[model samples]
Target: MSIRHGLLALLERGPRYGYQLRTEFESRTGSTWPLNVGQVYTTVARLERDGLVVPAGEDEAGHALYAITEDGRDELRRWFTTPVDRASPPRDELAIKLAMAVGTPDVDVRAVIQAQRAHTIQAMQDYTRLKAQALEAAAARPGVFDPDDVAWQLVLDQMIFQAEAEARWLDHCETRLVRLAPQAVADRREGADNPPSDGDGTAEQADGAPQRSPARVGGLRGALRRPRR
Candidate 1:
């Protein structure tokens, strides 16, 4: 995806101007990532400014042809070997708001979870509509002459996959939260039962009886301690 580096590499093979490099790069890639003449010229200028490439000669119109210098070849090699860190994907604002809802005081976490489940179900409905549309469109197409049409099917497939996945995950979250709601309420209740006073549950509540959370293995889920709110 580094057009700059790719251009330098092509020049390393031989001196070539913008037009030739642009044509060749496009033909080689089956026009996957189209290169414009202006882009090629701009990249060449930057390389020249960086001392990575120099003007080899000129054609009849005095159009500059560039050749990769030793430094340019070195840079091209480094580019081939060095990793380019792709930019992290954009934030999902919905996910951020959901996390906030989970942590916010006075918020009913169960209600928030239900809302998320509903939202995901709505998304699944929308995606299902689009999925049907894509299937119809693909069936209508006889061949892959238009790459855009080909890609449209894949886009719809991906959207469908993601929507269904979100719905399933949301359903799981809702179900688990429903099961845990009574436990959470009971833990917070002030005094239907006695309250613990000692490190062990030895001391009595203000009602003159000891109360504490039930002692259990709590399966694989609860040796870890949550921090005090």
Candidate 2:
């Protein structure tokens, strides 16, 4: 999230002070990306220095006001038009942890995946519950649509989707680990010798199979490529 761009976008509406910008930004974004008042002031100052915004004047309460300039409008246009740079993806802590878990001595990679799956599932449940409550609250007051409720719901939906994707990715990681295990090769050989009657030969692994060190998949680079469901 670019705080500078966000602040600039808020200023594009009209002249707004620091507090007003912070409040409006939170209201529009459902507080998903919170901005400190000091941070807002600092960003505004930088905007002024860069000639993106000009001091409109103080409000009635003596709060310093700012208004976006032509340059700021151009910048905001570029921000909206240009696609986000995915060539250099942001670092995700979970991805980093999972990448380290593979091939690391004494680390149970399956256990790590399971732990993350559980946590992600719990977060998804929480978001679902919140969405239900938000809908119920909105339905109680008919005819009047509150934009804040809608904004919050949108934020919740994004979180829910992310949690679901995380869970799926974790499951994929476990499957990949199992497939790359040494015993998996031996199991395939055994199946070749004594094929299952079903003919699919996709039976589960037998007990007491020898487990080998988990293999790393190109470090953290390949982690972003989610497996198809």
Candidate 3:
């Protein structure tokens, strides 16, 4: 997410070209967030512009190298010490999809949740397999120390944990929906039996058709409105 900071962090080690920095970033992160060569160069250029990095001559192979400045080091240090802000969370597509599905007519919200659960579980399993492989490699080379491997393992662990948490949250959503089903049905029936007027002394459903409001469908929509941290 913070490509600039990441680049600065890598530059702290030694001077590196755009390609080398991109490679190192992917290698350290297990390619979880891949960066193209252009992106690397773009970020480096910005850092140079901001005085966080400087164009350090060139490598022996003629590649343009970049070195971090004092300002860069200070910024990297602050980034390391500061906790990531979580007061405003990023928009989760799955959360938005589920919320919309719950309110939309003729949408099977449970099916959507189940499908996402399956996908998330599969991802978790894949991450678990990768973690096992990483551990096995580490065990085989007990006498050796590879910081890259350690970094990758940490990244994989975070992804695995996130997937597991998502699966659990999906289960909770399913259970809550099931528990509220009866009440939802009752509300729908009541709404159908007593349709609300349209303020012109005429029922909105003048044709005696049943109307399903978001609240009448399920309290799930209301539940989604509350903030969760």
The lDDT of each candidate is 0.73, 0.85, 0.90
Best by TM-score: 3
Q: Give every collision pair in model 2.
A: none
Cα misplacement distance, residue 66 of candidate 1 (Å): 15
Name the weakest run of 10 consecutive residues (lDDT summed) in model 2.
208-217
In model 1, where is the ten-residue run with the lowest total lDDT? Answer: 215-224
TM for candidate 2 is: 0.75
TM-score of every prediction relative to native: 0.44, 0.75, 0.84
Minimal lDDT window, size 10, model 3: 198-207
Q: Mind giving the per-residue lDDT tens digits that candidate 1 earns over 68-159?
A: 99999898888888876433334676566767876578887667767877887787788678667756876787764654455555655666
In model 3, what is the error at residue 124, expressed in angstroms? Answer: 1.1
Task: Give the number of the best model, judged by lDDT.
Answer: 3
Off by over 4 Å in 2: 141-145, 183-229
